[model samples]
Target: MIQRFILLGEGYTDLYELFEIARTNQRRLLRLVQLDTVISGQKKSSLVVILQPAEPGKLMPLYLSLEGVYPPEEKETERYQLFEQLSHELDAPIHRLEVKPSADFNELELYFQYVIGVLRLNRFIPPLQ
Candidate 1:
């Protein structure tokens, strides 16, 4: 299966679009993740919506709004609240992880690769097949 992160945008107006994607594709929705990271002494989070692979293609698209919202543990935000609400509505627990900020990587693709490795190690996603 080819798992890829499809970044919508920073968690501004694009967050609503992410929610809609989860809501509309609830059946295909596999997991909701909150990636917590500290960037320059500020706690931030990335919201990810993991979907099952598509038929015939085996393409699993992971939708994400990277490092845009303040993690609810540190500060409650409307964006985080909506994500929580979506988790409740979907009956899927939000998987949280602490990770290095994207800025640490020389390129954005490297950052994503790191995240994929972490997810695979945690068994949140499947291993190589």
Candidate 2:
């Protein structure tokens, strides 16, 4: 299967949109992931929702809310709480991975590719075909 990352926004208020996507597409939901990385000095999280491919589908979508969440360990953020709620509601386990911050990459696209490679390597997503 071919998987592509679709960026929703940089967390903030747009996080609700990610939740809605999961709620609305509950049946198609395959996995939930929280990508954690330290930017500058503070720890942040990017929440991702992976959905199964739709009709005529070779493309599986990985919806991302880029590094907009405060790591719960340092501070209990409302947004991350909501993500937890989503996990309970969906009966899905939220997978966590430590990754290099997108800022480390020269291009945003390269950063995304790096994440994809990581996800595939961990068997979170299918292998490249």
Candidate 3:
């Protein structure tokens, strides 16, 4: 299966778009993830929505609001609240994990590859075929 991360921009207005996608694609929704990272001594989070592979195409899209939102653990934000509401509505528990910040990578693509590797190792996503 070919799995890829589709970034939806920093969680601001983008959050509503993310919520709508989850609500609309509830049937294909696989898992919700909150990737927590510390960047320059500041805590931030990236919300991700994993979806099952498309039939015939084998393209599995992992939608993400990449490292833009403040960590909901420290403060309550509407974006995080929306994410939580999505979990409740879909009955999908948001899997939370602490990970290396994207700043650690030289390129954004490298950061995505690292996340994909971690996801595969944890069996959250399928291994290469």
Candidate 4:
């Protein structure tokens, strides 16, 4: 299976689009993730929607709204609230992890590789075949 990260945008209005994807594909929903990181001395979070691999093609898409929202533990935001509600509605638990900021990486692809490694290590996603 080829798992790839499909970045939507920073969690501004694009968050709604993420929610819509979850709502529309509730059955295919595998996991919802909240990646916490510190950027420029401020705590922020990135939300990810992991769906099961597509049929025949074996392409698994990990939709992400990269670190743009404030960590809800520090401050409650409407965006995070909606994500929580969606979690309940979908009966999917949100997996939280502390991670290095993407800015720390020299390349964006490297940052994604790091995230994929973390997910695999935690068994949130499958290990390499």
Candidate 5:
């Protein structure tokens, strides 16, 4: 199976789009994740929705709002609240994880590759098949 990260910018307007994807593809929803990263001492979150692989193509989509919201545990924010509401609506619990910031990589593509590696290692998503 091939998995790809479909980033939706930071967590502002994209929050609604995220909710729509989850709601529209509820059956395909596999897992919901919150990747928490600390960048320059500021805690931020990247929300992810892992979907089942496609039937014919076997392309697994990992939808994400990359580092969009301020860390909710540190300080409350509307973005975080939006995520919470979506999770509730989907009846899917958010899985939080600590990770390196995307800025650590010189290129955004490298950052996504790094995240894919981590996910595969953790078995959050299946490896190549």
Candidate 6:
């Protein structure tokens, strides 16, 4: 199986799109994750929706909404409230994790790989082939 991150946008405004993908692919929804990180002194969050591998290609999509909202635990935000609402609607609890900020890496690809590694290590996603 091949798993890859499909970035929606920096959580600024496109988080709704991520929720839409999950809602539309409810059957394929595997995991809902909230990646918390401190970027440039600001605590932020990245929301992810993992989907089961599809037939014919076996591509497991990991939809992402990059750091767009403040950490919900630290401070309440409309975005996080919406996420909680969506999780309730889907009956899937969000998995919250603290991780290194993307800014730590020189490139986003490296950051993605790092997150993938963390997910695999934590059993949030399948091991790499």
Stronger candidate by lDDT (2 vs 3):
2
lDDT ranking, best first: 2, 1, 4, 6, 3, 5
lDDT of 4 by residue, 6-122 (tens): 999975579989988988988889999999999888999999999997666688889999997888878899888888998999999999999999999999999999999999999
Every model's TM-score: 0.97, 0.96, 0.95, 0.96, 0.93, 0.94
Which 10-residue window in model 2 sums to the lowest lDDT?
7-16
TM-score of predicted model 5?
A: 0.93
Please give the lDDT score at residue 50 for candidate 3.
93
lDDT of 1 by residue, 1-129 (tens): 888999989846899999999999998999999999999999999999999987777888999999999988799998999999999999999999999999999999999999999999998999878
Question: Model 2, 18-112: lDDT tens per residue?
Answer: 99999999999999999999998999999999999987788999999999898799789899999999999999999999999999999999999
Per-residue lDDT, model 2, residue 40, is: 85
What C-alpha lDDT, on a 0 to 100 scale, does residue 40 get in candidate 5? 85
Inter-residue clash pairs, candidate 6: 11-68
TM-score comparison, 5 vs 6, better candidate: 6
All models, RMSD in angstroms: 0.8, 1.0, 1.0, 0.9, 1.2, 1.3
lDDT of 2 at 116: 96
> For candidate 1, what is the total of clashing residue pairs?
0
lDDT of 6 by residue, 1-129 (tens): 778999988654588888899999999899999999997778899999999887677798999998887877679989889999999999999998999989889999999999998999999999967
Each model's lDDT comes to 0.92, 0.93, 0.89, 0.91, 0.86, 0.90
Clashing pairs in 1: none
Give a tens-digit lDDT track for model 3, residues 71-115.
776778888888888899899999988889998999999999999
lDDT of 6: 0.90
Report the candidate with higher TM-score, 1 versus 2: 1
Task: Report the Cα lDDT for residue 18, model 6.
Answer: 87
Model 4, runs deviating above 4 Å? none
lDDT of 6 at 93: 94
TM-score of decoy 4: 0.96
